[model samples]
Target: MKRLGRRGFLRMVGAAGLGWLAAACGAPPVPSPSLGSPSTPQAPLEVASPPPPSAIPSPTPTRRPLGNANVPGMYVRYFQPFYPPTREEWRLEVSGLVERPRTFRFEEIRSEMPKVTREARLKCVECWSARRTWGGFTYEALA
Candidate 1:
């Protein structure tokens, strides 16, 4: 048996380490052909054609009533007109526990003072109200 010195032992360890490293980092081996020549081309595979579309049955006709059978001659109205009273016919009366209580026509009130218009909201105690731009005289003016 031969005994290796320190330098020879180090050299042998380094060679074994390099061989293991090479084996771990080596590229994959090329594949080999088993059945035929690698350069030969393969024929394309054939598939059967799909079956023809089936004939669809026609739909049957449905019968329904056209309009209301009970009311035949009924017709709808579209427009309506609104008419207001004339200035001569307009009147306002205030009568209560007061010394200056009086009744006056619209013409007499118009002649007494200038009219004032205002916008106000009338709210109810039940938490519901409507907003409106009112055009009318105040309580003092009416009084």
Candidate 2:
């Protein structure tokens, strides 16, 4: 048997915990098909209808206003070590199978590109969600 490292063991435990959580929070179980005698037909199972749209509460953000980078809830996860670079030394590398390959400085990108803002909603499979206002220059702006 292969030995699992501390990180691997932790990841496996985390996955199992998530699986258990999902199982615990799952929808009501469906009734199994009956194997009753062919002579007697099983009665049709009735399902309860969901409440109307009006009865359901809206999930739109209202109580708290949208937040920025300095917001308390904002957090970062670095899978790898991060090293900050000086603005002058840093360059946006754009390369690959393209007609023209170029590297642009942070200052150049900021000054020359046309910027746009977009409202983005991030949702997870576990039902966790977040909304953010993202602002950046488009591909056309970079071109």
Candidate 3:
């Protein structure tokens, strides 16, 4: 086998890490006949001539323009990672060296806790940076 350099190894590891992260936050796509889902009976394949240039539809803008607040994250996703864990299943537990110990669920926390949003930059060791909007309640808020 050929020897792998540090750069090659790191690249492979980073790709794998991203793949794992994607999987962890992933869910099966909606079953469709086009996708040949196991439950769906697939149609036999047919070779057809390519459509004429005019017959093809031109690509149109289907999404709104990205704004400053729309910074993409490395592990970015608009959907909840769980599928997701129901609001009742996600718990924010507080304990140890606190006056009152309490476990709050997602909805409760979101409804009760004060939320903060600020623009911040995340600098990676790989020598790149990106602005991110951080939103969350603090420990003091929890207290």
Candidate 4:
């Protein structure tokens, strides 16, 4: 018997692997059936009607108001200011086994770090949420 070269051996191994895979996932082929003659249609049946009521009762009289029902109309109160605090005033402090631990302002961090924008789906505990496009620096970059 002759020994196979590197390329020939690889090709034979690949072919055997494919054959094994095919055999492992093998399923019997379905046979096609011959066309038969068409059958005749049937007629629709009619439904019966329900019976009527025997005796009807007399209607009751309406009740009168108890006391004086005069009341004043109240207006709903509205507040003026609705906007939240600015992100520029936000601060984040990190402390650990490091040479320096400092508190960073939002503007300071934004100016120092290279920002990356990413699209992600945020799911709430209530099973309702939205996809948000957020811009932030990674922990490695921050470190």
* Model 1 clashing residue pairs (backbone): none
Residue 104's lDDT in candidate 3: 93
lDDT of 1 by residue, 21-94 (tens): 99999998776676455564487767878765564546778633332233223243449855878987776678
Which lDDT value does model 1 have at 19? Answer: 97
What is the lDDT of every predicted structure here?
0.67, 0.77, 0.78, 0.69
List where candidate 3 sits over 4 angstroms from the true fold: 1-84
Q: Between the candidate structures 1 and 4, which one is better when assessed by TM-score?
A: 4
> Given candidate 3, what's the lDDT at residue 55?
96
lDDT tens readout by residue for model 2, 48-77: 999999999989885444332234354555
Stretches of candidate 2 off by over 4 Å are 1-72, 79-81, 124-127
Report clash pairs, candidate 3.
none
Ranking by lDDT: 3, 2, 4, 1
Question: Best by TM-score, which number?
Answer: 2
lDDT of 4 by residue, 1-143 (tens): 88889999999999999999999898876654543555555866667665445544457776433332222232234588567658877788877976678788878888998888897655544444455678898876666
**Pairing residues by index, what is the TM-score of model 1?**
0.32
In model 4, what are the clashing residue pairs, if there are any? none
Better of 3 and 4 by lDDT: 3
Rank candidates, TM-score, best first. Answer: 2, 3, 4, 1
Worst 10 residues of 2 by lDDT: 63-72
